[model samples]
Target: MRAGVTLRSYASRYWEIYNKISGDNERVVASTFRMGLPEDSELRESLTKKPSEGMWQLMGRIEEYKRLEDDRLQSKSKAPMMNRPRQTGFPFRPRGGLTIQKPTAQMGEVNVTFEEPVHRILDWIKHEPYFRWPNKMGGDPSRRNQNLYCIYHQDKGHTIEQCQVLKDHLGQLVKVGHLKDFVLDPGDRVVG
Candidate 1:
């Protein structure tokens, strides 16, 4: 089989394991493919320079990138976590709070009632580098009413109050003990 076919197969399997893609559009797949490339590879640079290329053009660059990524993943499996050079540029600050909870099978939906309105909470954290605005939700911009604005999406389709992704992210933070002050628990809730 050709390198392009092999690369596509690898990408398909990768998406199956880690995420669900909504469409088979080559541009979306190529974007995902670029993201999965090993950080050290110059292929990422080339891809960034020519992001509008079709899959046929992208395939020519794939075989070497795939080999590099395979080697990186293999070495990662063998290396001790402490020994690897720390990645720079990610703005994540290690919080002095509670360690992450192991996901439980008994986890059920909980309707969190925050001490303050969510919009206010979001406003407080908006400047944090770790906070990421979600991708713009797609729609016919002219047809939809622009009254409701979602800060998370920075779009007009919905209000921040109605944004499920923002709610879910806040819930995760609360569960991890970072946002305990915002949570309205009847009993004692400790902030990490």
Candidate 2:
């Protein structure tokens, strides 16, 4: 017999048995119409003539649909909960400490040599690059002394190396020059 005919025969037999067991009259009617069997046709004659393999295939499709639905429900139940709050600002706080103070002016006496113009020394000190070293290097000298030393060093091409007194106050002065190196008279003024 032809393959189509054989398959149709087997399908019709399965549909008949299924209809008898399931008592689904609508399915039996639909199957009969699909197989070209008239509403009033003889079931035994239809089976003998042609059969169908669609009923079992339809049943397998229904089983797959049920399995997919079960899987979707299981995944939803196993999902993690969402509870974290949204952040609104900076992650760290500002540190607290002493604020920087502005430079203040003070007054003091400075003795400049006769050969050195006082005004020139004063200008040099006023414009000296005070920022080269940290403020902690020297103790606060009176404004006049600070001004004199600044100008004196700048004009004579002297540096921190030539001034032992200033260097001593800065804690960076060594014993490269001694007080006895220069002659001092009774009326001579010394600021140390």
Pick the lDDT winner: 1
* lDDT by residue for model 2 (65-162), tens: 32443355446666422321221111111121212111111112322222222222222232123312212224333432321112123222222324
lDDT of 1 by residue, 1-192 (tens): 223333334543443332233444778767877777555447767787878477546654664565555456557667433322222111111121212221211114665667766656765664344455555567687776454445456455555556777777777776667666776664644456
TM values, all candidates:
0.38, 0.17
Report each candidate's C-alpha RMSD, comma-separated, in the order given. Answer: 16.6, 45.7
What's the number of clashes in each of the models? 1, 7
Query: What stretches of model 2 exceed 4 Å from their correct place?
Result: 1-26, 29-53, 79-192
lDDT of 2 at 173: 13
Supply candidate 1's per-residue lDDT for 72. 68
